[model samples]
Target chain A: MENEIAMEDKNSTFVVLPAYNEATRIRPVLEDIARKGYNMVLVNDGSSDNTLEVIKQVKKEFPDKIHIFSLLINRGVGIATQTGFEAVLKFNPKYIVSMDSDGQHSADDLDEVIKPLVTGEAQAVIGVRPFKDMPKSRSFANSIMNILTRIFYRVNVSDSQTGFRAITVEALDKISINATGYLISSEFIREINDNNIPFAEVPIQTIYTPETQAKGTNVKVAFKILLQMIKHQF
Target chain B: MYLYALIFPIISIIAIIWFITRYFKGKNSLITVVLWSIFWIIVSLFAIFPNVSSAFARLFGITRGLDFVIILVFVVLFYTVLKLYFIVDKMQNEINTLVKELALKNEISLDDEEE
Candidate 1:
């Protein structure tokens, strides 16, 4: 299923969802995004599960409302997202909002995230989640990442790990990343900060399920992120 | 160890030969070949005359020749690491492009089939 109207709308806002194994969880989220009439781009990162089928089913329902892309293999979240960004930029969209497909990000808060861009308040808007409500361990790691980013790169963002973000065409054009892993979050902040892009944040509710809460940033992943940051410095 | 000095010359000889052959075969750029050639020459020199590093070290007010060689090795490794990082970064970008194009083409072709 393909959406002919995917990029034709000059004034339309796009929501790009990079899916992994979100087969069951994202079915309803896709429905909600489609129900809201937002242009959708679903990127399946080579899920072994039935994610591709779920997206295929959703696309069949809203052929004119969404575009679905599945990578031939599993490239991590960063690579999938970069694919989505590159995919949407071809249409010359005015505003592009990216969210995770794991149902952590709300389709309803889509409006608020993109509002800053729509109103010309900020060229880039990050969907900041309340860390206090999160699990202690994951929240602490995220907070350390935020602090490290500010200390090392001189960029201040509340939620450095938040996947939900709204960026204008100009801001998206300035964003270039070389990470194939999770450090794309840090790369995004560095790109915006380096280019002096106007950045803003809006509070968004993060609905964490049991699975979401359990998927914490372990030591291995955290070390990789730190190594990527240090590697990128060179 | 004194034995490390001998190994450095052996490794340097191999590197020099490899780089020269690669340059002539058009596998490496002329600049890279020349740079590697100079680097190996310095390594072989220091390896053969361990006291040379000490003299050089004394000029910079350092203590021992082995310390000087170790410092040089660290610098070379650091430079190599940075260069390799850039190559890896470029490969990542290429992968992103390849994946993006493949996904888009697949989606478009499927849509065309439906039409």
Candidate 2:
């Protein structure tokens, strides 16, 4: 009876990770998360590489420390994250945290992102990556998106594009998500604005790799973000 | 005959215009409106103008330009729907990936020692 009650209370928080082609680093990520004492979900976005192999290995070693969702085909990051959220809802977790699988976000920073959602101070808690690690052009683009989000939605968010965020199940239920691709970030801000949901941001560290720096947001993604925002602005 | 043809086309034209207006207002997909309007135009041309109908039959190996237009619109609409379906499919794929990851995490967290 005591264990049953404890299990019911245990579903208060969940850590969601969306991974694609991150075999080289996923094992270490899972290891690091294993030390943090939080539930972890890894969404493999249909990688065409050894990502699944690594996940299989991790599952064998830490069967309870890691869970893997191997997609049959590649889906965009937004959809993967949303699907994770919907699944976690069944557990009735009070707070949900979304982190990147590429090692860009630190598991240590999970507390900062989950604070607001857990405390009832804000409906959403976002991890704002320090501008120092980002390229100037990317920073400029994010700033523009933030400004636009504020001007159009009357809300101020430090980082609208950051993958690290936390929100309550209630907020998750209220927020609308229509985007399937890269534009989901903009759609998130739009939904939050349209619904007038309360949100806050905490500064978090960003780790950069040679590949991540080289693979910054492209023109096509930028244009998509702009078009998505324009669609909702009217 | 002329009056009947004119009236049918006019009504279709009005419907097309209304649909286009709604599309411009972001109430519908633009491609949807264009596809439907093109359909109505072809129907109107064949039904209202017999000279055009007969000219089309004589000039080309076609029987009715209006019928051709209907087939063309359906083809275009079919393609458009297919393309949109793929987009939705892709989106659903992402959602599935995310859900699977979450399920795995929930399972692991059960044994997570942080409590």
Candidate 3:
């Protein structure tokens, strides 16, 4: 498996990291991924911190392996991720994987997440995190969102809100993302169902530092997502 | 006869005048000025003669003129809110597209510079 992955990592996979206000935590994540030899597309979502500087420094270190873009203003994660997808697609990679930049998604899981796409078993793969390992508030919100996604989109998945997922270039070409916020996760599932794309789910490690825990969706955001879902249904 | 009846018509007349002035100044569209002027005129007429509103309410199967007014206000408010939501949503999507395009263009220019 190691040899096979190493051979495939020769520019066949591009990892996308969409970041917002993650200046302090993004360096280690980027370095970890860079050390693994996979190409990266980093979208610095108009972060209010020095995240762009950090990204540029990292780009200098791995100039051949990284492509960076910065939105002039902070659009939400959805648009940022979509922009990353558009940027990476031009490179003609076999697969594209999107992961959070706050270090919640471990780089070690990158190979496992991309394996199904390589093996012809699935067109997309979702890196599922164990709810039992999450904080109570996040777990509760995730559970509710999971149920709502199942109900609204008719797609069943254990983790509907996971930021770590991989898609084939073929599947990526078939779908267009419209949501501009965190609700983009649900929109992905909707696109999968609508396009009849094959998908798989794999368990992945999630590291929840205080910073990561403090940056995700809250009750108000969840409510807005729900409203957006309803609006999309019609 | 009542103080409210006298005050409301005066306020409505002022609103009507303001709407017409805005239209003349090119700050408001013709449709907007017409609609607002009609609305204020109705309010003035309703305040001066409450019976007319009651008659209008009966046409809508509402029992009281005040209840009809409340319902009308809510419907208008809801319509305005929905319209504004769509406008903002469209503007946001456009901005996202513009920003994405610029970012992509920047990436291409950077690649050129590196070469």
The model with the greatest lDDT is 3
For candidate 2, please provide the TM-score of chain A on its own.
0.86
Selected candidate, larger TM-score, 1 vs 3: 3
True contacts kept of 2: 0.24
Decreasing lDDT order of the candidates: 3, 1, 2
Q: Which scores greater on TM-score, model 2 or model 3?
A: 3
- CAPRI verdict (incorrect, acceptable, medium, high) for model 3: medium
Q: What does candidate 3's lDDT look like per residue over B8-57, in tens digits?
A: 88998898888889889998789987877777777887888988888889
Residue-level lDDT tens digits of model 3 in A99-206 = 999999998898888888888999998999999999988889898999999999998999999999999999999998988898999889889879999999999999
The estimated TM-scores of all candidates read 0.72, 0.65, 0.89
Worst 10 residues of 3 chain A by lDDT: A1-10
lDDT of 3 at A146: 91
Candidate 1: stretches off by over 4 Å: A1-11, A214-218, B1-93, B108-115
TM-score of 2: 0.65
Candidate 1 matches the true fold with a TM-score of 0.72
